[model samples]
Target chain A: MTSAPALVPRPLARARPLVEPALREAVDRLHPWLARIVGYSFGWCAADGSPSATPGGKGIRCALALLAAEAAGGAARDAVPAAVAVELVHGFSLVHDDIMDGDELRRSRPTVWKAYGTGPAVLAGDAMLTVAMATAARTGSRAALGELVGALDWLVRGQAEDLAFESRAFTGPDAVTVEEYLAMASGKTGALLGCAAAMGAALAGARGEAVTAYRDFGRHLGVAFQAIDDVLSVFGDPHRTGKPAGGDLTSGKKTLPVLEALAASTPASSRLARLLLERPLAEGQLTEAALLIDRAGGRRRTEAWAHIHHQRALHALHSAAPLPCPKADLTEVAAHLLHRTA
Target chain B: MTSAPALVPRPLARARPLVEPALREAVDRLHPWLARIVGYSFGWCAADGSPSATPGGKGIRCALALLAAEAAGGAARDAVPAAVAVELVHGFSLVHDDIMDGDELRRSRPTVWKAYGTGPAVLAGDAMLTVAMATAARTGSRAALGELVGALDWLVRGQAEDLAFESRAFTGPDAVTVEEYLAMASGKTGALLGCAAAMGAALAGARGEAVTAYRDFGRHLGVAFQAIDDVLSVFGDPHRTGKPAGGDLTSGKKTLPVLEALAASTPASSRLARLLLERPLAEGQLTEAALLIDRAGGRRRTEAWAHIHHQRALHALHSAAPLPCPKADLTEVAAHLLHRTA
Candidate 1:
């Protein structure tokens, strides 16, 4: 097949210039040392404080916030605080999640805990979260601030469950079920994105069903995005993603694909479950496990779930009845998020 | 001097019944595991999840919030959310502080990170903070939420500076100065107390100068409380405090007493500086350092500073011109805070 066009959403570039400066200013309120750590986390600088060539994560949440505000009949610039708050929260969660997961790398760079000590990394995460709240409060919008805090509550709860899953049995009643897995993903990956959209709408003076629609839109999109991530982590090219293939499998992460595969209960699925129960996968076993998972229809089932959620997200957006230009912008961004290789 | 009357303030009893229920409700929103860890930190339960008999801290900050509201012509019950928010923030800070300081013990029991793991403790702290913001937002007062967020920012900044001090030289240009130490204490301890008072008043609809007065009152009182705590940590009777005397000294904490003594630059202070530079303080070195600090007028200077701040706090309270009954209650609490033995 011919190569598809690139999936860069125009809204991201549009949002970056507005959100980046505000994000930096919020982080600047932290102590100089903490600011340095957070800056590194944002890919603004290297570990030693020099400017970095590597770019930060796509400001997808920021773009969503800006577009949501615009769609709700407010200027995108008016929602800059919402964009900054969500971005700070996103960075904070990543930093803490890395420490919790004991993952030492992100985007091919050392994780905050690996580069700085765990204690400093902990402080850095705390600083970012505090900055997020302070930035959100600056908007003088209680609804926006409430949305941010609610997302935080869900985020931490989700993280706690995700960690607990690591110790759970791979099979039987005590094992993590698919429903439990989806709930965890909704909190872990979805809540902040939901907040990003909801806060933007709220800041724009949108209330009632419209805000809910935007929240649902972002939440469903987040789940879809996470589902895609699970597939790419095991099956995509390492060169494209800048991460090792099957690393999640070797690390024993309870991704949607693996959970779905185990639920299938076919011969391959049974073997896959038993294989995962081993404390550490032996060399080349990761590839074998991936193959078994794929054979058991894990990849296809996961993709189907992604597609379902992706469609639900679009439906939510359509129900929101946003301004035409920003609605189209949001649709383009959502499609890109679903299709991105990295 | 003859023994003085006990320093228990009646406002604590009044505040507890109202604040505790709200605080528990907020904490209940966390994941079960996180709630358990946080419960242990709050002295509400043991490591094994059984209820604990040990009474928690006096909830001074909570009482402050309640009294501030009453003093500002609002019912104390009206500020329970503010009271609960400050208490949660206080507990959150302690959990994270224990991990950051690597202190294994608190109130003669294992710290949260010591009983649970560090990662869980980190999540517990985050849970409490999220609950705090949520609780504060439930007040539906933007000013109150803003105050709480501002205090969190200060709390984290102070903690970062306190950790940075551990690696700084004990003397010369690189040493932590008295001003820096006070500033850190203000952020670390004063900010939350200030927020408690300010938020209560704000929620009470007391604007402008009354809120500022309450904030300054609590801030000065908190600094004074910290000064006294620094002195007590070194010299207080272990039986009464339920902690080892001179633990702070052995830990090489850059508290007010030590900072004052070092600033004196006397021969004893110079000797104290050299003795501290040795890693893993030798046996009896703690008592020696305490004595050297005392001989250099550190103890007196610290006490004098505390007295000054205490007086300033009372003056600010008087300037606020709150209602007569609550003002009297606040004065009683302030006196207890300044003079408490433990």
Candidate 2:
């Protein structure tokens, strides 16, 4: 079990100071009301427009962008705009996703749509997306812009699929397959991470095969990250994850572990499947479901899946042939992300 | 009064055949459910994904793009991507705007959100915007991409302002002013039109001054077009406009006519102000409000504003030094747009 202090990798620490100022400046370009709503999303302010105590996201994507730039033989500062743009896009997705999922909490506070009205939250999400495109365009790299837009398209498709999957039966021919889950996970999470790495490399004047390899590395890494998050959501401490234990099960989200559990034909797995369909599950039922998933080997299978992707990510990173120091930093960051408790 | 037949300007008729196929192709790349929702937005399908009899938007922006390209010494076909991209963006805005304004109808059909659910409509709008950005980026012109992004930002800002204005008092100092309405109108409408024309020229290999002049022409034309729309929402025949008469007043939209009416200090205007504060106005009250606005000179003033922008548009078009045939076609199109009854 890694200590909380160890979660902040040196690369993330280095990248945060460089990226936060640029992110703030870009957000300030939005309409005042929109800026306020978006600011809350970033943990910069409370719902009342006062400073907040809660810290924002981990800045993993920003660090990845800057590190990719350095690995591609450009200074980290060259990818500041790319970093800000990716963060904005990520924030935009969370704001809208909460509305779509009707989730009321995020980052230990009310979601954007919960704090503001749905209409204003929708507008804030749109404003963030608009600013992201504008910020990316300012980089003046056609290839980078193309990558960002491509990722955005995939991200939207991924979200649409995720929402569509919720109503699907837990067991049947209509059930979501593990393969389908992987594809959705790639599009929803991997695409933007891939774009962040690709944009960083492209902005650093890296071309062709090297950039492709970097993108591949990031995509695989993103899948691993999501898998870890899926595990933590059900099994980790609620205080650390900032979500109730087994929240995803109660919400009926089709995460990898649940899908894996259903694939298992054991009695425990069958009982787990039945429990999930009777959603708004009691806390005790949620506990039973989690235990059933573990009993059916779903937890181990999901962990193995994450490890497989981690290996693939490392292979792609080696192919990218990054600069020695940045390569080492990226490795450390990757490890932290994959092994973090929250 | 210009008839419906004359409203289909020659350029628009020509551009539609080229643009629609490409537009359909771009939309086909979306998730199946999203494509269906977006197709509904284009009047190409019904809520159940069946074909529909309703006609789509006029493709006015598409025509402006194609014509601007030809004017810049490139073939109109050279700007097909630009035309398609701008129309995608226009459709995107309409889908989202309907949600924000809580309007249930557009183009004589149920609005996207009204037909589908709000969540699906939001996803569909996002998909269209993503496709638009990808299409513009495919043109491989950084300047054109910049123009498109700038317009999107302005469009978002304009919408935020318009939404914020709805809660403001109609008579107090917080009342939306004429100047504020014009600025919002330019952002809400002019920015995209300007982007359409500018992107067309940029893609046609036109440089600095020519592209700027074309953009200016489209921006002013957009303001004129919106001014006409404001008047029609108040006074146009329901059968022709495909909306209830005085619908904007009933919805409490702060359009140019309403702002002008509020600015006036006449007896009719004072009563109209009082009437407006009681929203969800009755049918008879709406009719009386329209009459009061007309008696207070709002209709005449709004028409004058439209004419003023019309002159400004033509002046900018002349300065663009378009080829003779394209110049004549654009001038005719401008006249039809400014003078159409519905």
Candidate 3:
């Protein structure tokens, strides 16, 4: 069942003032050029180092961290470093992801690799990764660095598989399976989100079952988030997505719905598979392909599939949420992620 | 004053059997293909995943880490995690360095990026970096991770400036000065080495002053090591170097000798200056550049410069060598680094 919407405080908005300022302060200490690159990546500065008020990511992951802390019966203020660390790590992955996937735009702006040359972009990502661990260290927990770095391995593994899947999706007879897609999504999206929540809870001194449940909640939410993202990538309103229509279909990324549609035995699936194998989908082919995907029930299947994960996430969130902890806002956060346009 | 050579035990040889296997065990836990890339990068496997012993480095850094543990009166076994962590970090840097510099050969074999495509290599390096931090966390010390992650920031900053220097050296009139070169070297080479020693000592329960002294010893040794490496890059016998002659010069790397010669005003230095700005070295220009570097006293000056750092390392080692701890093997490791031909 859908959880009740947040009636009072907005969790992410509350976390932003603390999270954003701390993130800016942390990266500000990087080397001059690195600081400039970070400033650009985070929407604080333009390419020429001038101020730019480009709104960055909604800090959803950052909010997950702080909310996890508050939901474990701790003050949100106590988890500021944890919030900073996860956001930095998320930015690190985004910077490197753009380079690896050869994507040109992120959040309606040029990717770091596109705006800067590959060398600078890659190194800048590396600096961010290093800074993430360093920032986490200030949390004074033996487990904070371990949890974040451990999540990174899963994240990288997921990315590696994602890259490998692109070449195999249409050609290889033994293409990646739906189960493999779920595993990859779990690692790529869910692992870091899980770490973000766990780090926040651990730093708040919420040990044992509370930590595990929070981590599970984040992971399932992440997979559900990935499924929703896949659905939107194909059918989203560009005005809301801040991206051109059919970006993922054009990029040939092996998102879950596409894989599911490809695996179907329907005639529309046959057309979609043929179109995928034909390489560059011709001009109007994208619109036709989207219709074919819908006809093959890919969109419905992915959306329905997401609800399973959403239910699991809610289950985990409720199971371990102590009565004293503030979870109303967390439930609202989850609902927003599920209902967001972009 | 040169410390007497090891008459008691071989430092690196004794440390290798301990370091190598632990490294293997560490990466063995990474994702499937990621493990294979790591195996190839570490020279434990060929491109096809078949076993191959192409000979990794001398494990000099690894030995330094383990020896630091012994020097702090801890069992060598107690520092295996630290040793593995440092070596993994070193390999992580090497993998990324090859990609960044587009070098094909490492230890006389194909670089990771060359053998595996850039995408897999980059992700593999990311995996290695993740594992390095995770393995360090097993030491049960929050300080271990903090120290290691801090050193990584310095290392990345050093590499960034080193790349920046390459462009400035040939394009701008204000080429990198000796002090700037030294600072970069300290960050690039000294920082990780310093971290290694500090991690080992800290793991062994060595507190405050002892750890600082150990860190200083490693940093000084790293600079000296860098200087000697510059000398060998230009002048060492190819058979010993395991690299084609003048590779660094042809690659236009701003090594110490080249930087020193560029700053000199002698006829040979003047000729060298013109040669460097003329773009990529022409046929036989590498040989000529080598001679010009020598004529400008770059070889002598760099060697003498190394000796000063060498003295500082020895002084630090002696001052910090506790009575209960072993020193003979540590002294040998020092002499070996200072005097090795390759």
RMSD of each: 1.8, 1.7, 2.8
Q: Evaluate model 1 with DockQ and give the value.
A: 0.76
DockQ of all candidate complexes: 0.76, 0.76, 0.61
lDDT of 1 by residue, B1-342 (tens): 123347566787778878888888878777998888888888889999999877788888989999999999998887888998999989988988888888888888989889988888888888888888888877888888888988888889899999999988778989888899889988999999899998998888888799999999999999998998898897787776766777787788888899899899899999998998884686588778889999988999988888888899999999998999999999988888777788
Worst 10 residues of 3 chain B by lDDT: B1-10
Q: Report clash pairs, candidate 1.
A: none
Candidate 1 chain B weakest lDDT stretch, 10 residues = B1-10
Question: How well does candidate 2 score on lDDT at residue A279?
Answer: 86
Model 2 chain A, TM-score vs. native = 0.97
Q: Rate residue B141 of model 3 by lDDT.
A: 82
Candidates in order, TM-scores: namely 0.97, 0.97, 0.95
Candidate 1 displacement at residue A320 in angstroms: 0.6
* Model 3: per-residue Cα lDDT over A194-296, one tens digit each: 8888888888888778888888888888999899889888988777676668878888888878878877868998989889876567659988889988898
Q: In model 2, where do residues sit more than 4 Å from their true spots? A: A1-5, B1-7
Tens-digit lDDT string for candidate 2 (B1-342) = 344444477777888888889999999989998898988899898889899877888888898999999999998888888988899989989988888888887877788888887888888888888899899888889878888998998899989989999888788888888888888888899988888898998889988898889888988899899999999999888887877777788889998887888788899889989999798899999989999989998888998888898899999999988999988888988888888877
